[model samples]
Target chain A: MQGKTGSESWQEVWDKSVNGPRALIDCWQEIPCDPCQEACAQGSIVLSSGICAPPALHAETCNGCGKCVAICPGMAIFLVDRSIGSGLARVTVPYEMRDEIRLGGEAWAVDGEGNYLAEGRITRVSGAGRPGRTMLLTIEVPEEWALKVRGVRGRRKLLEEPEEVEAIEAVEDFAFCRCEEIDYSRLREIITQGEFRSLPALRRFSRAGLGYCQGRFCQSILRSQFLADCPEEDREVESFRVRAPVRPVKLSRLGGEDG
Target chain B: MSLPCEQLDLLVIGAGPAGLCAAYEAAAVGCRVTIVDENDKAGGQLSKQIHRFFGSSHHGAGKRGIEIAEELFGDCLKLGVDVRLSSSVLGLFSNGEVMIDAPTQLCLVNPGAVIVATGASEKSLAFPGWTLPGVMGAGAAQTLINIHRILPGSRVLMVGSGNVGLIVSYQLLQAGAEVVGVVDTAGSISGYQVHAGRVRREGIPVYLGHRLLSARGSTGLEEVLVEAIEDGTVKRFEADVLCLAVGMSPLCDLAAMRDCRMVYEDALGGLVPWHGADMRTSQSPVYIAGDASGVEEASVAMEEGRIAGISAAEDLGSLNSGEAAERRAAIAKRLDELRAGPHSRGKLAAKERLYAR
Candidate 1:
């Protein structure tokens, strides 16, 4: 709610809503998809900005339809109801785990970061439906933690700590071309020397783009390296010269000879 | 010994979703169809997809790609459509002659109509240390995990935020590998937010507006360095595998060899053959479908293949014009529906330009 979740932005909708329970479409990104909008039966979810726009919920019209919860491809949607009791609230979230969470079973409620928030009981577990593979799990939590709880712990752990990556001093020494095994340091040296006037000349000398893949993997990198080094006045980087055998054709097949 | 040459009603290339759909449609309508693919097994990349597809149920949505591929392949076999596996179409002549290289022998076939659906290849991204043995295409990683049952590495750094990157990263976790993070040069996540959400909920970080600068290792990929596009600040992470899901380009070499007019459309994944609404290329009696026409999902490719198959069948007089028009109209309407979303507007515009000429 404070940082990346952007759930605080929906405070106005939450404060103004008079409905008993409703769905919160927490999707913040404008990606080209509409399964959530289509999933709602009441047509409360709308994408006014075409297909790629983030879904906007018509709070009053939304009857807390859990349809959007299971259909969301990103699992970004959740249903929250804070007016249920004095301190009790219900939060329904999408679950794709293989092991199903049991109804009325004790489970650990986690926030967006998958950190332990509080222990809650699973109110309901919906089976796979029109939403295809995604299942819905509703958990009753403290009214204050309704917005904070996003998912539940299944048989497998929700989050795993990422491996530690040490900081390296230099990255330019790495290989740029995977197919031809051309390293960036070598290209940097070639560009600094200015011995070659064109990409074709550099390609001929280094054999960077002459791999089995026909330079599909490294031609762009070569061009970028040349552009990065060239002065603004001389910024024209020529394209790679492609030959007829764009795909790898066995020499024996071409010569009509068999092994 | 020289192989025997035979004439067929239709010859479909590539055996992918598009190719299989085209063969099935054409064969169902009583057009003698034969499909060929370079791989020892058919299904193309579909076999490696373990995630559920998005689309209406009519388009095989809600089904995993492997399931759809099995169903299509089963249908093709039941229809008695001749499927030649491990056979690559070596050459395509303007006269409708196709030279096929099979395991046993190299043979030539003259067909009344041809459907080119060679599909697309994964677009590569180059950075320092990208060529290390551990770094590979996201599709290759998918093939290794889902198909070959091999885990690529313990720690994976995905270089792209597109659907492939996001989906494969999740699959990596499912395969018991750790996904360090997903890095993209774009300012925002390019894939569906739901996919990003799934990864985020799993405690994986999605670094938008970050570019992978280089990979470092002695023999294989040992670490990857990424830079924030906005601030130019660099961060290094230990990753045994670097998956490149930058993008894909339509494999159009076969189409180009046949002298089909090629047009550059970035939206359709670069250098695509210009074709009409019927999927007929500039060359008559020759049609193109699936990624060869443009880069799109398997659902769109299947529909395009159906249209091409019906068009080819009509051209051979096996199907009447009236029936062909109805079928084409129905399939076209479904295609329009599938491409109606914001993500598909560019593809729609590209298709419009392709057919406009």
Candidate 2:
């Protein structure tokens, strides 16, 4: 998770080695998507729990068709062939950034953390597909760093100097309501005062939702904070009362006077 | 203070993709169409989207949104659709009467048919310091970059991993801004993998399961504190601007005023007017399309606009029932294809529930 050598478990799977071409479904979470399975024309990609499950690839059945590589919405699918050559291996990943890496151009392979890993050359660049707006790029990397190199920086490096985390106190003192100019500390102070019991009382005490835009923006914030402070079992969340003239309107304009 | 009212065959509110398409379709069918939008320009949010759209070629899949908007606007103009820019519909009366505030005068319009395509408004998330001057909506940032040709800030922090957040983060990078990272509370990235891949490859770190706790600054945004939900670890990242792409809610104020049955569907972005297959609301002569009916893609909105427009034209006797049915079927088929993805299952169910009655 720290760097982008895919995930640690994926890295271990890649390190264990395999023969020929294989599709790596780097997706771990059970998201409501299964385009990768549908993209596999060979029936190699399978999911157990309908479309909401992550795809499971059958390495033997996957012929490295690269269809799943092009169709994956998460761009989590990758094709790796360690048996390409003695020292050189091929890795196909989706590239959709603005700066396109032309075929045969020098590709700067980077890890998951955007750190430069090794240099590679773009071997192939595929055209855009249907739903997924990504183009496939096959890069030739060293056999050892094939799995570690997850992406290629098409343009410049976005490496930033590591900054030390300063010990900051009272950092949560910020504005909660943009319309009413209410800060978090102020709202917290009001909450701790214990005078306001209901949302309307809170509104009256702090003027959190009395701005021109009404409570359309701040009411949710007030509710969330109230819930966070008070246990749900102890208090029921109350919504702000809505009135006529829901949206802001000029008095003169309401009078039908032409400007 | 009663003003003289103009009569129209069909009145379209908003000039976005939906409203523009609705106006064009109705006007092409010989219905006297008038489109009213609050903005000075006609292309609503479409003008701000510089990225190419996704879907079939019929929906302008390969073309940029700005180009698509231009094409729609050109069609509306060529078909002689009356466009009222910088005109806001102040109130929508039940009797097909709309009170509008134009630049010059306050006027009223009584139309035989009404189509609401007012679109959606950005939903904000509350964190400490979210109200700071530098913090703004991702749509606002996109507008500033693509439309206004201005960068909101040099170092930006995007909250949300949905398509909007991912796309806007990429756009921010394209506009020469340093995206600190994209943070989302969801365990997995909510947006398309292509968009996420694009931003990830650009070296923008995406922190999943991380919720924005607070934004710390005095006069403006200085830094943002995001806490990982799983471990409760807080990390502060340096960011001048905080872009909230949390979500969007349907702008159903006018629709509600018209007494259209509204439902709070979380999948459809909360508080959307109940509309049917032809985009017609419960109220006769009143139709809803686009995000005003429910938050959806621009492609779906365009199709819904065409369907609503054809329905309105048929109601006005400009288009025959046979022609309207054919057009609606074709558009509905295309719409079904667009919503046939796994990600759109929720939206599909939401649409079903909306039209169940």
Interface RMSD of each: 4.8, 5.4
Cα displacement (angstroms), candidate 2, residue A96, comes to 7.6
Task: List DockQ, one per candidate, in order.
Answer: 0.23, 0.17
lDDT of 1 by residue, A1-259 (tens): 1112235335644643334567776776554456766778987777675554566777666777677776565677787777667788778888765455689888777777556777888988887543336677888888777777777775455434344344445545666665677777787787778777677788888888787666777765565567577564644344344434444566665556653
Chain A superposition TM-score per model: 0.75, 0.79
Instruction: Report how far residue A233 has shifted in candidate 2, in Å.
Output: 12
Residue A207, candidate 2: C-alpha displacement in angstroms:
5.8
Candidate 2 deviant stretches above 4 angstroms: A1-107, A111-117, A120-155, A160-208, A219-259
Which pairs in model 2 have colliding backbones?
A4-A112, A4-A113, A73-B193, A74-B193, A174-B129, A175-B129
Positional deviation of residue A99's Cα in model 1 after best superposition, in angstroms: 7.5
lDDT of 1 by residue, B190-276 (tens): 877667767776678888888777777999989888877787777878889999997887887777778888787778887788899
